[model samples]
Target: MRKRFVMLTSASAGALMLALAAPAMAAPEADTIVTFDVTAGSLDITAPAGPVDLGDGAPGSTITNQLGVVAVSDTRGGATSVWDATVYSTAFTNGALTIPVGAVSYWSGDSLPGSETGGGTFTPGQPTTDDQVPLTGTAITAIPAFSHSGGTGGSTASWNPTLVVRVPITAQLGTYTGTVTHQVA
Candidate 1:
């Protein structure tokens, strides 16, 4: 009986050692989904700070001046992003002496040196002096963001425009003031 009891105890001890030596069974893994969100940005435009000054001219003569730098910045990111910049003007009047809006011509020359940044294509509304369009109280495109080759980035474009005014052959002479407005979308 003593011998049998010793053999049974030895077998139990061997089984316990084997169990401790082997790796434990792994628990089932649980998965947690991860996620995030990104919001859209904004598009904006900056016009030159000025009351643009077109120098003096005699009656029936044409007066000209530079409207300074006009800029458009697009923060809205997309591969095919686009926008347009339009310009409008208020008639120039100096107490009874007036310059009609139709007499004002705008020439958006080109993007200034190093003024165009980011990625995309910028098209000037008036590429040259000959392309100048008259202001008739209606908004005309000053610049157009036609295409974007970049993957998902913003773009900017800026240009200096020339304003030409035709002084009517009337008999009044005074300093004329007018408002030129620029808008973008």
Candidate 2:
């Protein structure tokens, strides 16, 4: 009985040592964090859809056509405030024959970026002036054509203005080319 007891105690001690020496079976877990930031909304202006063709007409003739401009904003939450857009004719030239700025006229009566089929009128009061030419290159004369202001982000406005060109009797017979620019502030 003493021998048997001694053997049993020795086996129990060996089992305890093996349990203490072995590695833990459980795994520890931890968390990882992440973050970022976004920039404010923005405003954009697109070029006119067409070249605003006045077509072929005899000198002293008033050629009329429509010019369109589209403005947009990215502020979807309605944080955006007042927006003013102005339109101007840069210049028109037929090679050596230059058309004076005063010869071009802009009229407005459309609602918020009016269009031809949009049911807006071109009553010629927006700019309150018939002549659109600026005295100097840096001085841009605004056209009394478009009317668009104040909007939330993702808002869009269109300006379909009437462009009238008075062909000077002295205008040399040829094709004329020019550009119109839209500015937002």
Candidate 3:
């Protein structure tokens, strides 16, 4: 009887040891997830400084001046790849001595101050309406779009445009002023 009791107790202890040694079921693999989101970048432009102050000119004389256009990217995602510059002009008026928009022409050259290296090809603009025209000449009629190549730091570029106005000998003698508008995209 004593031997049987000892054997039973040993069997019970072995069973308890085996149960404790078995591996846990991995706790059902508790899982957690993470995520990230980003927003799109944007573009911006600065209009040329005004009162360009052409000073004075004689009849048939060509008055020359320059305006600078600057483009910038906020770089939210990356550098801007390309951009376009659009320009237009309102008729010049010295209290109604009207100077038609056709009298003006513009051309661009050299990366002006604050401009990046990837200078772009420029197409002249033409008179398209009483109030609007391209920046270059009548032939192109559209502002030339440029690449951000040439290492423009992926964010900013600038241009300088020389504007020419032929003052008709008939232009009534007085101070004249007009509005030139610029847009970028």
Each model's backbone clash number: 0, 4, 7
What candidate 2 gets wrong by more than 4 Å, as runs, is 1-39, 74-80, 112-140, 144-154
- In the range 18-135, model 2's lDDT, one tens digit per residue, is 9999998875876789887655666566666676676778888877766654543434334444445566765678888888766776664344523322112223235433544332
Model 3, poorest ten-residue lDDT window? 124-133
| Candidate 3 residue lDDT tens string, 36-147 | 8776656676765677776679878978766555444434344434556666677788996888777876555545465563333332232222322234433235454333
| lDDT of candidates 1 onward, in order | 0.77, 0.58, 0.60
Ten-residue stretch with the least lDDT total in model 1: 142-151
TM-score of each: 0.72, 0.58, 0.58
Q: After superposition on all CA atoms, what RMSD does each candidate show versus the true structure?
A: 5.2, 7.9, 7.9
User: Candidate 1, residue 53: CA error in Å?
Assistant: 1.5
Stronger candidate by TM-score (1 vs 2)? 1
Clashing pairs in 3: 124-136, 124-137, 125-136, 125-137, 125-138, 126-137, 126-138
Q: Please give, for residues 59-158, the per-residue lDDT of candidate 1 as tens digits.
A: 9999888988888777776665577777888889998878888888988787888877775567778888888888757565333312224435678778
Better of 1 and 2 by lDDT: 1
Q: Which residue pairs in candidate 1 collide?
A: none
Misplaced by over 4 Å in model 1 are 1-38, 139-151
